[model samples]
Target chain A: MNRQIHLVERPKAAPTHEHFNLVETSIPKLGDQEVLIHNLYLSVDPYMRGRMSDAKSYVPPFKLNEKLVGGVVGEVVESNSDQFQTGDVVTGMLGWEEYSIAPEKEIRKVNPELAPVTTSLGILGLTGLTAYFGLIDICQPKEGETVVVSGAAGAVGSVVGQIAKIKGARVVGIAGSDEKIDYIKNELGFDEAINYKTTENIQEALEKACPNGVDAYFDNVGGEISDAVLNLLNKFARIAQCGAISSYNKVDDQGPRIQTKLIKSSALIKGFIVSDYAERFKEGAEQLGQWLQQGKLKYEETITEGFENIPDAFLGLFEGNNLGKQLVKIGEPQHAKL
Target chain B: MNRQIHLVERPKAAPTHEHFNLVETSIPKLGDQEVLIHNLYLSVDPYMRGRMSDAKSYVPPFKLNEKLVGGVVGEVVESNSDQFQTGDVVTGMLGWEEYSIAPEKEIRKVNPELAPVTTSLGILGLTGLTAYFGLIDICQPKEGETVVVSGAAGAVGSVVGQIAKIKGARVVGIAGSDEKIDYIKNELGFDEAINYKTTENIQEALEKACPNGVDAYFDNVGGEISDAVLNLLNKFARIAQCGAISSYNKVDDQGPRIQTKLIKSSALIKGFIVSDYAERFKEGAEQLGQWLQQGKLKYEETITEGFENIPDAFLGLFEGNNLGKQLVKIGEPQHAKL
Candidate 1:
């Protein structure tokens, strides 16, 4: 029997435990060119909040009473294809179940010896590549220019700040807590980190942090915090609209007015999902892998355990319970022989 | 004596006739590299509204009790440099006066035979270049794609729609009056036109006009209308943030929430001034001029007689009283021999 979670209802406000249900189901038998896998790690992401609403978006809404699915790293238990044999470690979109069945072409095998298997979901996965493309392609932070990132302690924002640093930019981060602030500033080598929860004037704090004025803004947390940063943008500033985690739960939320500043500064704002650069993913991952090997990039993950706790892991995202990448460890992966 | 207009007070809402004071003053003596000009036509643009406020913007605000300034087309009456001679038609940023003196290099000499002297202020000047860069560089409308333009009968929008049409795009224009709508569709060759003021549901009207969904949006009037357009944008749509004529008067106006639509569609919104493309001005102008000569572009101007009527011409922009370019004709240009 495979344990999995299902979306029982659409979320009206912030997603609650009632919205999801955990149940047991049988693992499907493998078909031709198909592989059966035992799931090891399941990834929870902020963008998934957008997928819960039945409104039009980049990705379709999750179906009610259907099995919830997302990025997962798993160990292939049985295979009927030449692409993979039992014991191969692979990652792809899969159900929250302990075991999943998929075609061999749907999963990409990763070398466990090259890096930790879980990095396929965090630093070296979609989260890190999102940072790489959103910053480098959209913002293109120049050397000595100031780059301010909101949700600075999150999986994506943390990597964005580090990449901005790697490119010799002045990095300033905004996070919800002091510990997240310290992690970004002290551990991640950020130039400055501001705990927005304690700051009286966010605009003033951002103004002081970016004395040269904000040349590029990687927005992960939108709302009042983004409004403050918009006020401090310099001429020709670039904004990478990554996520709006803060106001995602609000019904009919309106942020600040930007035309006054955006026009006056002749700025550029572009929104993108990581898949927009799917053709260039290999290039980005190679660069990120090289950076990790060279000790230029650092990352963290706040992981939970068990397949039954998937709903809790996903709920913790809305409450800001996790520090970095939020992952659920379901089982250990056995690497295939080199 | 030169007749000119001066800004008397900053307007709280819509600017009135009382906000402007007509004055007659002696023309200043010509200095080295100076040229005396007799203004032929003065442009009244929507962007000037931003400059009327004391607030910071792309251009500096108009000074209180000082001579108002904007784009002017004139003919040289006297020259103190080799760059110009008497009766040479030229265009530059100048005071709203019948006669004025400026350094020769500050004004560019344009040929009357190549196009009308007034074209320097409308089709062949800043107005045309604005539409060129804002459309081509920002939106990059592709063939067969739907391109929706707000303020469609205005100077810049008219040009923008025509350029999109020239690129083989399906053009839909949003204007205010039925007459303006007819003009854009019939005279300007727009595929469709929407009269936003009369429409009960703008989003529905836009939905009907753009059956395939909007692939590019050239925004002139911002606020609610733009919000409607934002709702209909398709995947990877581009938005040229040209002007927010609707909200220029409102204090701290919040246009619709773009973060939601922009993110879902992965759209791009860019705010720009014409001068931002100064280096590419030559290329943009050559293309515009070629289009005008080839009959691929058509334009209209609602010319108001007399130099004293500059304020009325400018005030009419907010009221949507004019079609295409609004120009105040001060005098006739004496063209220099070719």
Candidate 2:
């Protein structure tokens, strides 16, 4: 019997493991156009917090008493569709369950010979494409420009800093802890790192670190830290707002006031949902995969074991517990490193 | 002797009438590439408020203790170049004084036979160009797209609403009073009008007024009212932030939080200083002039008499006291209607 976790209710704050219940059932018979996936890994992201609530967002909110869905990597156990075969590894929107049945149109079969399947959820997935498009298409980072990334240790922020560095821009990463700072600077090769938790004066730190003023700001956290970054932006600066992790989990409205700073600096602040660029997803993925193969791109994943731990893994992202891509180890690692 | 005002000290807040001191001096000597103009009408605008402050803004701040500079229409008193002759009416950044001298490259000679010289400072000048570029270039307002303009009773905002209407979009204007609101909708041909002061609930009014949600929001006031409009924006909504009249004069450092709404709605909020698009100024001016000649665009001016009243005229913009193009009738209207 395959056990699957189903959502019992919508969570108001940090979702505990108890918000879901594990139910054992026989896997549903695959339709003529459907394939059954034996889940190997499931992604836990900060954006999932928005889905957990019934409030209107970019996408429809998660329904109560329904399975919570996110990005997942798995191997096809059985396929009735001609597009996919049994034993074929694939990735798509799979809920936190041991098994998933999706139509051929919904999943993309990964070529394991090209890269690890987990990378499908990180560097080669929505996170990578988001960073690629947000930095290149939105901010259009110029050479020698100063780029600042907030929530620098997270999936999207991590890649944004790396892409900015690759573009020959000075990269500054703002994270929650010293460890995350080291990961952003030492491991990820950011030019400078600021530990937002320990810094007494964010404005002073930004001035000391970014003397030239921030030309581009990739905002992942929207709060006082964003306010500090706002003050440090140069005239006609570009701000690519990919996420607001710091305020995502807040029950009350506590984000800092930043409209005045934007006006004063004549800045361009744009917020984008990655799925809006689905037509260009292939272009982003192909370029990112080449970068990874050439050793020009790097990624990290904080994996929590077991399918039941999906909620906790997601909650950990808001608490700044994960260093990079937050994921739940649903089954076993299906693909060996190339 | 033709006297001219020079650059003066930057003001921290609302500039007083005393901030600009009248000085007596010989008309500036024009070199081979220069033209001397006897000042006629001086234009006062909201953008000059930013230039008065020493803060790093889009345009360089005004230098201390000198006559302030702005767009003005005057008559050429002397010409040292072939571009203009004495008695030719011209308009450019001719400072606030009785007389001025500018490089021939800076002045654009206007023919009173085509239109009034003061019209060059209003409908055919920076205010007109700002509306054309900020609407057509930045907002890219398509035909039938719902367009909303704040500060719609003022210069740029008034022109912006009318242009959007001419483009076939359902235009809504927000003004401070019922009379202004009536003027915007009835006289300007806007689809709807909102008296922001009398409206108890802005969000509800926006919902009822703009039932389809705004496609392009031409924001002149960036505060609570704009924030309310943000929530009603559809996906891919474009916000052209031209001014922040709501918070410009407020001494407090607080305004509504707008980033979160922008993120959830996947909106684009951009701030623009009109002069940045100087390359397109000629095209804009020509188009605006045609629009005026065809009677497709109409503009009104709140002409305050005398040089001493310039500060009061400018300050009136923040309070929404001016009807349309706020200008001081400095000296006399040199190029009058025949």
Candidate 3:
């Protein structure tokens, strides 16, 4: 039997469990060039929130009363393609179900011997590439320059801070909790971390943290936090507008106009997603892997153990409940040995 | 005696006539490498509004009770250096007075025979250069792409539209008056023009004008108009944020958050002043001159006579009263021929 989660209703603001439905069905058969896989892990992300809305966006919105799809690592239980075999581990966009049928072209085999299989979904996958390209290609932080990143404790932000450090920039991170502050500062080698939840005055805290002024910004959370960083920008500051998780749930988010601020600083703000740099993924992935092997990069994951808890893990992202990449451990590989 | 305008008080919101005071004083002697200029044309621009207040910006705030300084086209009535001679027409940053002193390095000779001397302050100078760099370098509008420019009948916006046409892009202009709309579309050859003041729904009008969607936007007025343009951006759209003239007088300008729109389109927004491209000014000036001489580019100037009218001309900018470049004719050359 297969249990799959489906979007039953569109969310106007914050998503709740009522918007989703879990349906049980029999496993499907595989066709030519297709493989049947028993799911091992499912990745949940903040950007997924955008897919729940029926708005014009980079990608099309998820359909109602249908199986929801996302990144997944699973083991092939049956194969009708020569490229994939039984007992092989792979990763691709698959349904949020216990058993998934994947066309050969839609999935790629993951070599567990290279690193942990979960790393294929986190540190070495889209999350890490997002940090790499958005930081290196967009922001381009220079040596001794100050780089500020919002959502500093999350998956992409954690990797962004580490990469900025590697580029010799003075990294200042803004996160919600003291634990996230300590983790990014002490564990991730960030120069400074601000607990935005406890900081009575964010502008004052940012000024104190970035005394030399911000030259580059990686914005995951936008709102007053972004406004504060914008106020302290040096001339020619570059901002990688990666995400606006802060305003993603709001119907109408209003703030101070930023045109004057951008003009005064002669700054550049570029909004992008990881797939925009799809052609250079190999180069980025190789570099991130090398950094990991050399102990120059580190990562953490908050894994929820059951498929039933997938919605909770996704919802927790908005509340700042997860540190690093958030993933759900579905089922153990039935036919694969690791 | 020399006549001058001074900022008597800083304006909290919109500047009024009371904020300025006309003063009279005797002209001073010139030192070595100095020349005395008989002011002919004084350029009153929108950017000067920022200098009136004590806010930190690209340029320093105007000092209280001091002579206002700006771009001037004048004659060298007295010279103390070999670099300049008496009767030589020159243009530089000079005081708003009938007689003013300038060092040899501060002023550069303007060839009246090449074009009109007034062109030195309008088309063949900073105004043209601002349009050139902001459009070609920042927006980089490709052929067949649709380009929209706000403040499209003003000095910089007019030139930006012409240049976009020169680059083979479909140009759509937004302005305040129907006369200005007729001018940009009929005379200047813009593909379409919208009289934003009379347009019931700017977004719907823009949709009709730019059926291909907006690939590039040169934003001079940043408020509701910019919000409308931002909503219609195509994938990878580029916005040259030159000025926010619409919000200059508002103490606290508020508007819809744009981060999500930017992310949805994977667009880029860069704010700049002409001086940011000072190194390439000569290249920009040469191209503009060639275009103007070849009859590919056209310009208009609304000349307000007399130095005393400088404040009125400056204030008229906020009301959108000027057709193109706003200049106050202070005095004619007493020692030079055209």
TM-scores of the models, in the order given? 0.97, 0.94, 0.99
lDDT score of residue B104 within candidate 2: 91
Question: How does model 2 score by TM-score?
Answer: 0.94
Clash-forming residue pairs, model 1: none
Best by lDDT: 3
lDDT of each: 0.89, 0.82, 0.93
The per-residue C-alpha lDDT of model 1 at residue A95 equals: 85
**Per-residue alpha-carbon lDDT of candidate 3 for residues B4-37, written as tens digits (9 for 90 to 100):** 8988999999999999999999888889999988
Clashes of 1: 0
Model 3 regions lying over 4 Å from their true place: none
- Predicted candidate 1 versus true structure: per-residue lDDT over B1-338, tens digit per residue: 88889999888777899889998889888999999998888999988878889775558899988789999988888999898989888889998988889998799988878888778888888899999999999999999999999999999999999999999999999999999999999999999999988999988889999999999999888888888888988999999888988788876676445676778899899999999999998998899999999999999999999877788889999999999999988886665543
Write candidate 2's Cα lDDT for B81-103 as tens digits: 89888778888987877778899
Question: Model 1, which residues run further than 4 Å from truth?
Answer: A332-338, B332-338
Ranking of models by DockQ = 3, 1, 2
Instruction: Give the runs in model 2 whose Cα sits over 4 Å from its true position.
Output: A9-26, A251-260, A333-338, B1-34, B333-338
The A-chain TM-scores of all the candidates are: 0.97, 0.95, 0.99
